[model samples]
Target chain A: MGQRIQSLRAGALDVAPILLGVVPFGLIYGVAATEAGLGSLSAFLMSSIVFAGAAQLVIVDLLAQNAAWPVILVTALVINLRMAMYGASLAPHFAHWSPWWKRVGAYLVTDQAFAVSIIRYEKPMAELPKRWYYFGAAVALWLVWQCSTMTGIALGATIPASWELDFAVPLTFMALLVPSIKDRNSMLAALGAGVAAALTSTMIFKLGIITSALIGVLVGYFAEGSER
Target chain B: MIASQSTGVWLLLGAVGVGTYLIRYSFIGILGRAEVSERVQRLLRYVPPAALAALVVPGLLFRGDNPGLTIHNYRLLAGLLAATVAWKTRSILATIATGMSALWLLQWLF
Candidate 1:
């Protein structure tokens, strides 16, 4: 019982900084959805249902452009393909959970939550359980997503650009990223990925990030330093 | 009977909701059933760092249409400050508090 509480608390705390970033993005999406001709209720429901930030925003952006429904659907799923990688990466930690909880765990696998939890998971086992920790992360993210989108829907995305709330997301990523680089392979992987992503940002449908991420993984996997 | 556009929007949402859920669940459901080889394990290990870096750099260095390599992009400057703090303190709280304060101050000044 004590371990479960500790795990949950840790998950929620680790996710808090990232949640600061989500607030603005969610607000932008909420404003985008309603402006795209979605009924506010449907837009809110999309937050509750579809749940992925970038994909949800893409769907709304395409709808605003009057793209065909099939094009929108396919594009959003392509954006979500990274989640499959996340699922694969996260499987080892979640392997011991019941099948239903595993599915729930997959549903909770946002970029921030996965990054925050996985780094800790890679460490030697502590007394805290992974499931409760993940659940706490999901719950914190879920509430903020719904509330922020709602605020944006009601308020029309009033968050000012001057505030630069978007920076927080990458800032949170930067914090999580540095610790992951321990040796030559990991260092090269990080460098290769940063350069590739910067170069390929012009790709259509935002495929650059995932593609560059894969390149970085291959670089690390085949790189000639394995002293870890 | 009216073919309202909201109906189409609802269809998009519902379809995407189902599609994304399955996409997320795909490997989680399948991979847990079998033990992966050491080769696959090593590959998975690199995914987090690579993915995080991939997500971070563009947001820091690039703007909407133009690259922000110059000093005018205050976010990049602030991000460098954040990275150093993260590397040094290794605390999430210290990273965010110090980084964001630097960002706000940077944006406020120049």
Candidate 2:
């Protein structure tokens, strides 16, 4: 227990870059939430309650458009499917953790937290402290996201939409995706998903986006398994 | 339809929060005893990249409600090109500059 706490403290020191990386994007999401018709408190509360940036952005946008409740619900579900994947990936590293601790960690799951935690987990198991490593990473990410998002909301109504900085959202996604495309199967999955999304846009309305994503992921998973 | 500042918006926000929590809770709660199948575990690996691309591609390629292939819609084309360059170069700065510049110049021209 002492070792885990100490490691968590040490891990906190290493999360500086992760916090920095998330700040601009969290700011952007805050700006978008306000623009999507959420008031300052609503924006603040959404960030805190959901604690998931992309899902919150989409939900706010959907609300702005007065989308149906079911549609909004499904969209949030599809966008957050990756969190389940993150949970599964971290299972082995966290297998020894108490159920209560694991539940808390699951609640704190975000892309930055997952990345840092997985990296720390994959290290030499004998030397690394998985419990504190995750605690430090998750806490650091959660705090930075909440702080930067609040900062964006505070600067709201004054920040010019002309900065046209929203484009960075997709750019950031591109940065994330490129690094993972190290093989044919992965490439196929991406291409399939993109094409499927494009085609789905033609019929059955917005559900196509989620459908395409789900299909592409399934294809990639099966392809990888077959090859193995 | 609720106005942006209306009480309805607050209600909508609350609903969204509840829904988001439900989705997260499902996986973490239900899967407690049941291990993820190997197949499901393998599939989860591809969800991030594929899903993100699915989100971005339509926004780039289509405008308002129209989906078309045309030289006039160079923002879409430029975005794809920029993504390709980023794929090859792995330069976030370059990719954004190239993609946004393409959109800016094209908007100016046409």
Candidate 3:
């Protein structure tokens, strides 16, 4: 019992900073969603249901434009395909946990939570109760996301769009991705994806982004393979 | 009527959701015990950067139907500069300030 308590406490401490970091992004999302014509209710619903930043942005952008629903859905899926990878990477760590716990953890998994949890889990430790750490991280991230989003929505109508606040979301992502580029294979993947996105995006009307991302993933995988 | 979206749209969303789930859960549900070949595992490592770059490049470069190359399209240049600064400095505050300033300055100048 003491061990479980300690693990939970440690997990909470670890996730506190990450949640704080996410607050601004969530608020921006709220502002963007509303600016893009998503109502407050819809913005809240989208955040809760989609539970991913990039995907929500794509969906709301489409919704604001009144794009075809098919396009919106496919775009959302393509954007979120990375979550599957996150899930696969995490499955082994939580394999021993019960089905319910696994399902809950899956629901909670996000790039940030997964990134922090995985790094901590990889460290050599004795009987650290992995699930508790994940839960704490997930819960902290989730709460901040909800609260920040609500704040955004509350301020969305009043906040002028002139600040170009929407751009901050992607900028935040760029900041996160810079530190992760450590090797050639990853660099090539990034290069391939960027070129593909640029080239294909103008080639056709739909699936340009999705196709580029899928191709990028395959290219990155193949690039890594060739190196090995 | 709530002016709700059409059923086709809903179904499409559902299908996409299911497909995403299949991709994400595949390793756990199907390949849990099976070992991926070393080669395949190596390939999977590159997915992150490639996928991310694919997402962001299009948004930054092309503005609505045209590939604007002028200095007027300073946001992209600024973003790249910020990205470079981020890579070298690993400072989030500096990156955000640089990128935001670039965009604001560009908009003001244009």
What DockQ, between 0 and 1, does each candidate earn? 0.41, 0.45, 0.45
Better structure of 2 and 3 per lDDT: 2
Clashing pairs in 1: none
lDDT per residue, candidate 2, A77-117, as tens digits? 67777777777667666666677776677778777777777
lDDT of 3 by residue, A120-219 (tens): 8898655447877777778878878889888988998997867876666567657666765678767777777778887786554456666776676677
Query: What is the C-alpha RMSD, rounded to one decimal, of candidate 3?
Result: 3.3
Off by over 4 Å in 1: A1-43, A52-102, A109-156, A179-183, A203-206, A224-228, B1-20, B65-67, B89-100
Ranked candidates, highest DockQ first: 3, 2, 1
TM-score of predicted chain B, candidate 2: 0.63
Worst 10 residues of 3 chain A by lDDT: A201-210
How good is the docking of model 2, by CAPRI class?
Answer: acceptable
Query: Candidate 2's error at A93, in angstroms?
Result: 3.5
lDDT by residue for model 1 (B1-95), tens: 11146677788888898999997887788756565567766776676677678777877877443247877777788889999998998765566
Q: Indicate the worst ten consecutive residues by lDDT in candidate 2 chain B.
A: B63-72
Alpha carbon deviation, residue B41, candidate 2 (Å): 0.9
The segments of candidate 3 whose C-alpha lies over 4 angstroms from its true place after superposition are A65-67, A124-128, B1-31, B36-44, B64-67, B89-94
Candidate 2 per-residue lDDT, tens place, B1-110, comes to 34354676566656656655554544555465457787776776787778777767776766353345666566577677788878887765666667778766766777
**What DockQ does model 1 achieve?**
0.41
